[model samples]
Target chain A: MSKITSLADLKKKRDELKGGLDIRVKAIDPDSVVQVKVAMATCGIASGAKTVMEFFLEQLERRNIAAIVTQTGCMGYCYAEPTIEVKLPGQDPVVYGFVDLKRADQIIEKYIKTGELVDGIIPVNYQTIDFKE
Target chain B: MSKYSMHLLVCGGTGCHASESDAIVCNLRDELEAKGLMDTVQVILTGCFGFCEKGPIVKVMPDNTFYVQVKPEDAQTIIEEHVIKGRKVTRLLYQDPVSKEMISDSKHMGFFKKQLRIVLRNCGFINPENIDEYIARDGYQALGKVLSEMTPEQVIKEVRDSGQRGRGGGGFPTGLKWEIASKNKADQKYVVCNADEGDPGAFMDRSVLEGDPHSVLEAMAICGYSIGASHGLIYIRAEYPLAIARLKIAIKQARNMVCWAIRFSAQSTVLILNFAMEQEHLYAVKKQH
Candidate 1:
């Protein structure tokens, strides 16, 4: 992907993909769906999240998986470049550390395809604190 | 199944990449293959995992051993001891600057133990572009609920009640903004996400927009319905080329689902939607009350 030079080009590319794009809707049957999240924070990008994100999009499209790909800001784990979280509906979401194109492929093939937990997971570090208190 | 396996995830984030994270990745692959451990081990290059001060980081899987401040030269030893013999390289573990203890896992470290990730919920967990992974996490449920059972007013009420003040600095009540926009008499009102997050050291909105754009999209539509606006605008900064590109992709995806008709309006100025709520009508209604 070359640098997007203008908003018009951006719109043009979006329009071209419009017909093929598959945005996820709220699953009436949530049990059937899978969710993948890529960290797109500055830290993530400075870490190469762009490439990681692109790889997942391409793989998902090729595999014909009915999943929704999304981006989120920093998770504060800046040391873990290209972080990704996976949620296999009804199971707790797990955060995977240090993801790239190759790891993404394995994740898609193994975790997303076979539902087997693979390597590269960062253990839960923080406890949720109620800020209101 | 292999008797023993190790997966090495190398940090490919720009900072580390600039510091030869890519070279380190290549070297790891070469050394792993040279040691004939390629079949038993896997070396993967991944996006930023944060903790950027420690560049060229690697996490060995299964045991989840995190190694920080790795160099291209160290890849050989990592392959020899860690990958070949399954020995933990204690020297490479992340040492807390404060505690001075070599912390092997990110969870036990103070840097990772104090944050709550609601908006950043999915980052560093799944591939950013895979939707199934998102669906597995209940990604679009909010949008579905809003579209099916809740009226726009009800959606607005929920957001208002959720206590999610705008993360965009001003702390303006998001629900109230929707309420005002909903009351507006414009035939075409707009809902805008201020992805032009310009705060110093602030990448919150960018990460939300990047990692879980659907949440923002779902939230935006909920806002649109609440405010009776069918059109949406995302005012992202020009500085973030990657974020802009991803957001464009997200908008197209959103359109495919018929969630919202979105337009990317590129401008450097702070974005403020001109549509005003029908103030006179609200005041008149208040008078009647």
Candidate 2:
């Protein structure tokens, strides 16, 4: 709350603020936060990626879920337009295809909340640039 | 849950500010308040996003939607269509010139796709006036790291290893220069910063000063500590009134940060501009403002 006057104060301030910034940090360390990314390229938007993104953004708040909802360029699932990648804390990411409003609701309710696998789970054909536990 | 659900980051860089970006912020806030979403949303004015071609850029948080070439009148449409209805205004999206495709994310835009930000990293992200925002992004962490962790020789060694060059006419390695200065023995030492860009349309130094003044101040203090100098003097031209004002504020703020590691007993090592600006140019820039 006060100005950081010394080295110890700077360290304390960094540690305090690091909690709020963990999600945006360049290094991805899986912890208590869930990450939900909506594919929002040209074809993805043509297939209602906007609505799906909005649902995730709003519903997560409504249900008191701690999540970071973001939009990425594309996940290369044009055939299954409006795909979403959800990674719960400490779990590998899962990409779901053909995600409509109903499917998005199921994701927040079943997959994200209850930790149950839902329908429409598309097998991810690619891996992230960095492999994490 | 956080009180605000979203943050609307608007570009307030000089180029965008001149293009009615402030008006866009006002209009957006008014529209949000009318819709009772003001409490749920915050509109923040930030420095340049480096895409001056697309002046007045508005970026929505959480989802990373970048709206380019935004106008004051478009604020209402942005609120109703994008903020409320959850749809991006197609026209405002940055359009790729080659294929004529609309790009929702700024990162994918060609202008920023390949660029790596060094000095301008926090320029567009944080409100320049706020020092706390700058600190949150590790603004003076390097200064602290040097002060608490390393000796002057160690600092010079690290800088030498990095091989960072000064952004001046002559490409001088900064560490070697500091090492040379530290090696010389003198009763009194001084670190002078040349902020004079005599050529017209030279705003690189000015932009950095305006957008992220703390960075300059921190670097100056580091230079002071490294060169065994007790005083730091910045000789800037007077035509840059905005930069001058920002530097004053930054210098004041940095002084408040007590030195804990090694006393920069360099008693408040601050020296403002030497007033080398041409009188005619000062009057011209003042009139333009």
Candidate 3:
């Protein structure tokens, strides 16, 4: 690490370092940011969930979308090993099954950006107690 | 800024360390490695979270899940349930004493909700060991701004106008003190930071030093710039081993950044002397006295 010679250099250093802690900053009001949760159980990992998760983490930031990518247990879709659930602010979370890098990109560009429902969505088969009650 | 989507911040404060937070860190790393999710998740040992009563605390970022009293053995459960499944460990969540309801977020906690953190703003938030993390939070920006934009008189006036007072019980105006010190015409001047907390149960300074040592160092540098002192001395107690260790690391990193470097701003030479590092010199002074 070189010494910051001037104020401009310090500001540049700060900007370069900001991305490292961006997730924590966005997490403050999680309801306000795009929340992406990739299922990462044994079956999920076996089906390339790790790659899918990494793609979202890298792509969302690179694309300038405010998103929080996290890992979740099995979504009970073993057939779709690398399944992901994306919850946009003020909308119901949509679970997309068999999510590859291409599917994830489509989800971000189409479903996330334009709200156009893509083909791979796993319809909600079960309801929580909030719905049951 | 690596592609890590998740962050697990384990409290590395003395209080948490006593409860074996180091073992928790190791166990968490081992579990993450076993699951092959190491690249996706980043585990950082952070300073005090200020909730030492319920520590050792392990806070998960990007979701803001606060887990308290985290045991080393529970690392597997955190990785399996929280990190892997997106489900929070209810057993580890800080339950409200009154409602008995599990509070996952630290912001909503009864203890932290009402309090606004100023000086301790970056305490539990950033990795104290990593200078990049500190810089990410605008750590030395204040010093840079003061050095680049303001004159010594302007800096002192700004501090005075802000109604900033010394933390000491006397409530002395800090700007006035600086003015007084600056008026003294001497060949050599010294800005002394009193870090020796002798009052019983007073751990504020220690916490600040341990949690955010760079902030203290930056403030010292700012004071040096304001009072026209080329040399700064931090009179800290040897009892605070963790604070001392962190100060040494922070000083080294800041020196690398050139803010704490002997030639600060490339125009002035402000050397911050860590008294803990020069025990022999202090001993010599004491023997002479």
Candidate 4:
């Protein structure tokens, strides 16, 4: 670690460190950003969920998308491994199954970008109590 | 760069530490390891959450679920229910004392909703031990700004306009004091931070030092810049072991980042900090309101 001799150097260092805590910052107001949760249970991992999660994490930042990608346990969709749930700001969370890298890209570009409903969206199976009420 | 998807921040304040928050951290890590979610889910021991009455607190990020009074044994439940399933542990959430309502987010709580944190803003959020975490939250920007952009007069003027008073009772204007010191033409000038909160039940200074030590160091540097001082000293009591330990770590980390390094070749204000403990009884007696 070199000494930050000037204001520019300090600013540069700050920018570099900002990425590390981006997840924590975004967590403050998650309702305003795109939230991606990839199922990483044994079944999901066996079906290449890890790669799909990595793709989302990398591509979202590259595309300058305000998104957070988190890994979760099984969503009870064992048959459709590599499953992901994407929740756009001010919208219901949509779960997609059998997601490869190509499908992940589509989710980012189509569903996440333009809010256009795409293929491979699994219908909400379990009933969740609406906390908003 | 770590690709951690979720972060679990456990409080490591003196108050929370007494309640076995350290064990909670260990148990959470073990649980993550056992579930093979260690890589994705990051468990960090952060400073105080300021809600010590119900501590040890465990806050989940990217979701902002506030879990209060967490025990070491509850770590597995947190990992399984919150981290893995994305289901919040309702029983652990902060319940309103009056309404008996479980509040998931700390922002919504009445205790925090009315308060706007400035000095202790980063207290509960970041890991104080990590220099990068401090930098991420704009830690030494004030010192950088003072050194590069503002003159001593301008810095003094800004402080005056900000209306920040001395925390030590007398409520003296900080900027006036800095200007008075800066006017004195001395070969060597010193900036001293009085961290000796000798009063019983007064833990404000200790909390700041433990939770956000870098902030205090940066403030001292800014003060040194404004007052034409090259040397700095913090007068902290020896009783605050955690604060002292954290201050030592913060100083070392600042040195590694070259925060205390000489800015220019000439007129280098090499701000050196030393801890001083003396006359606790006199200070404590004087501090009594």
Q: Please name the candidate that would achieve the greatest DockQ relative to the true structure.
A: 3
Order of candidate numbers by TM-score, starting with the best? 3, 4, 2, 1
Candidate 4 docking quality: incorrect, acceptable, medium or high: acceptable
TM-scores of the candidates in the order shown:
0.54, 0.71, 0.87, 0.87
- For candidate 2, the share of real interface contacts preserved is 0.16
| Per-residue lDDT of model 1, residues B1-289, tens digit only | 1212345667654456578987887898888777776754656554456667887788765445689888899998887666544456888998888867778767677877786666666654433444434444655555545554566788888888987687654899977887888887986777867777666987667656555555666666667657776656777777765455555555555444332233444355323322212444223323432
lDDT of 4: 0.83
Kindly give the stretch of ten consecutive residues in candidate 3 chain B with the minimal lDDT sum.
B262-271
lDDT of 3 at B174: 94
Model 1 per-residue lDDT at B31: 87
- TM-score between candidate 4 and the true structure: 0.87
**Displacement of the residue A53 alpha carbon in candidate 4, Å:** 2.2
Candidate 1 stretches greater than 4 Å from native: A1-133, B1-48, B60-62, B71-85, B252-289
Q: What DockQ would candidate 1 receive versus the native complex?
A: 0.03
Error of 1 at B171 (Å): 1.6
Clashing pairs in 4: A27-B62
Using lDDT, rank the candidates from best to worst.
4, 3, 2, 1
Model 1, C-alpha of B126: deviation from truth (Å): 2.3
Q: Write the per-residue lDDT of candidate 4 for residues B197-289, one digit (tens) a residue.
A: 878898878778888989988888778878777767777777777777777788877776744432221112222463111234223322431
lDDT of 1 by residue, A83-116 (tens): 9888887888889989978888899999988889
Interface RMSD of each: 17.4, 11.2, 8.4, 9.3
What are the RMSD figures for all models against the true structure? Answer: 15.6, 11.2, 7.2, 8.1
lDDT of 3 by residue, B1-289 (tens): 6677788899988899899999999999999999898987889998898999999999999889999999999999999888777788999999899877789999899898998889888887888888888888997888777766677799999999999999989999998999898888997777787888889998888888888888887787788777767667777777877887887788778777754333222112222553121334223323432
Q: Record all residue pairs in model 2 with backbone atoms less than 3 Å apart, i.e. clashing.
A: none
